[model samples]
Target: MIREPTKKKETSVTGCIRCGTCCKKGGPAFHLEDKPLIESGTILAKHLFTIRKGEPAYDNLKGCLLPSATDIIKIKSQKSARTCIFYDEESSRCKIYHKRPVECKALKCWDTREIEAIYDRNRLTRQDLMGDINGLWDLIEDHQERCAYETVLTLVDEIKASKTDPLLEKKALYIIQYDLQIRSSVIKKGNVDSHMIDFLFGRTIFDTLKSLGMNIRRKNGKHLFTTTIPSDPQPT
Candidate 1:
């Protein structure tokens, strides 16, 4: 029987083999904001399996602290080996198609050159942001490899602390905490409260002087200020 190709929605990329290859642990990761879809009632989360720290990870080399069975997609090609935890196989489509992460929603293939190019560029910014966040910390590990994303997110806060813009700072801090929540790293250390991160990052208004490009040279690290640090907004 000959099958007809259906025209897909015109977005960034197209064509997924439905193989769970990309969704497995260590393949690509999800951040805090992305978890809402899964936690908010996605079918895939219930069936998706995870292998923990010492256990053998999925085809992508990621272990689950609590791995369970999720939906599966039969793989037709070696390149897309392993079933997708989100596929409905019987229907030949994604189970969480509408709520899939940015990466899954943005896949590309040989026929979609322009779409691939667009996806590549967009993916780079996100990947680079993760890399940037990783560089900011020294205690990061590759576990589920999700920790580094939050660590680097701290950098967004480093800048936020110095800005006089409360909204701007809150937005940046929100991004960092929001991401940590998605990665499930929010509870890793020191309570992982978004409010706490916000408090710490928020209270750091000292950055404004730091960003002025006017180096406040300390005499042996002592503040030259005869007064105390400003509590209210200074930069208008």
Candidate 2:
């Protein structure tokens, strides 16, 4: 008796190995197509965080640092391992595999043609997700105009260089506090929930400024702004 020939297996990275490499890193950016998942409770709001436009963040797919070009909704990761919150290490599988984000569905590590094709298409914006709430849309637009972060940074430079008067620091603090107050007022008005405030604004302005090595403190109902002036002069 003779046995039939064995079929040779195809060698391609296109097929998932369940190695959990991608999931271990972080979850995918949610697309507009994934709005239903959030609405249906398949993906919880607690499982997400926003990457604000112009914010510097790591681009996992591209393996580089780049500022977000548009506000993007992304899934949160486990604080301990920095992996997707839905990823189950014990099972080596995603807990929500069946209902993963659109980006996750399009991802093909071996060949990224599919994901690349729709990378900029159907992107979920912060406004798209939460703009329906009354006053929230208007608040976001107003806050952006009121506190242009780049402009704030420029103000900081002016203060440090003494291009502006010494009292300019006080003025700058007033502006920053005013921005915060605007957000506070919006929250108090009951347009959006307090818990969801951060979602609407993304990371707070204080955090963003802190990342630039600036210190902000509120003492005795007054804001104090302090940052070291670089001793080395910038090249012209």
Candidate 3:
């Protein structure tokens, strides 16, 4: 029998140990360039989740945590671990290897220049996915514009401006819980997937408020919003 030659593996960047650490760390952030994979059914909307603008996320360029200024679409991770959903531990391979997102394809552990170039670029927004269909997109936009974070911020600001008001605390609590329910209702309506709801809303009301330095306390086993650092307080 004649022997056949085995072809060598091709790698664009060096120092790939194939340990899958990057995949374990976090799923790849998707971009507009990745629409082809979705169109081809290699990746689906159900497989993705949104990280909304104004949420705390790692900024690789600055090497610090900052609010994401734009919406980001990312692959969901396995429930058991932070690894990419497509990652198979038993085989130590990507299930969608041939049609992986651009981020996965461009990643190079050693050089990483290609990946970094696309990391902080503009992301696909809900509107980006909108075609002629107005129903879901309209709902998404309405919910986003009316999200509780802004209302909470306004309430907090008003309270700060008038420190003499004693009723502000009660008002804040009412608004917080009300906003939470609003989100719940939208989710229950199912016009948009729950995961999609999360991304479009940015961080939840609790998280966004916390990031803004609002003091949270548990009262009767219910989270109560308390004081927040004044935007500008005159030094006593």
Candidate 4:
């Protein structure tokens, strides 16, 4: 009869402790239900960015990187970090907690069933918000067409196949140049807020290419491309 004293039962975490872990990782993607928040000015467009259709992005739920099927409008991170812009580091709380996005409300870190169920449902797109706006929407549409990931990826594949096609390289470079030029023109000529560039045109081609393992640099006023082996192959 060498029975020891009974051990204390461990308490399970059933609610968000506001540890700021989720906020630190990144902000939630906006959904249709969160449209009111943006429309009502609870969430501003300047605070957001878009992961445009066909862009390669990390899928948290699926735990892999893949091309987005549609626009995934999300809150921008603070500065150079992944921390949500609304996250107040000192207090470990969301500044807009009372008006958080649908995904933020649905997310339960302890039991992710709620989040995964609605992760990709009814995602809000830039068109839904600004389709009726004159000139701006047209600009965005043009940018999407000229700087599409589909065309870029195709050029990348062709470059890999030929390994020395200067013409293919030139086409890719032109697309990158157009992408940069449009963002610059929008800010300087169109008088659009520079902060809204990411939301309008998604990320720049430089970032997109780098994420896909291609590096570009300027030498003697000309851009040079260097390819590196991607650690993860494109998800099937």
Best by lDDT: 4
- Could you tell me the lDDT of residue 212 within candidate 2? 55
Least well predicted 10-residue stretch by lDDT in candidate 2 = 1-10
| Model 3: residues with Cα > 4 Å off, grouped in runs | 1-15, 148-179, 191-196, 210-223, 226-236
**Against the true structure, candidate 1 has what lDDT?**
0.34
Runs of candidate 1 with Cα error greater than 4 angstroms are 1-28, 43-45, 49-81, 111-236
TM-score of each: 0.26, 0.75, 0.71, 0.89
Candidate 2 accuracy as TM-score:
0.75
Local accuracy of candidate 3 as per-residue lDDT tens digits, 36-72: 7776878777677666655456665566555567677
lDDT of 4 by residue, 60-133 (tens): 66666678888999998888888889999998889999999988887766776777788879999999999999
Better of 1 and 2 by lDDT: 2
Residue-by-residue lDDT tens digits, candidate 1, 1-236 = 00111123464544565544344311223333454554465523223222212221132112122111221111121135344545555676665667765545544432434333332122221222233455322212332243232332343345445535455444544444443444345346444444333211221222323332212333663333222223332321
Query: Which clashing pairs does model 4 show?
Result: none
Q: How close is candidate 4 to the true structure, as a TM-score?
A: 0.89
Kindly list the per-residue Cα lDDT of model 2 for residues 42-145, writing each as its tens digit. Answer: 98776777767766565544655556677777777787666888989999988888988877777766666777677657778878877886776787877766
Regions more than 4 Å wrong, model 2:
1-12, 59-64, 156-168, 179-195, 217-223, 230-236
If candidate 1 were superposed on the true structure by all CA atoms, what would the RMSD be? 18.3
Q: After superposition, how far is residue 85 of candidate 3 from its true place, in Å?
A: 2.1
Q: How much does candidate 1 score in TM-score?
A: 0.26
Which portions of model 4 miss their true places by more than 4 Å? 1-11, 226-236
Which residue pairs come into collision in candidate 3? none
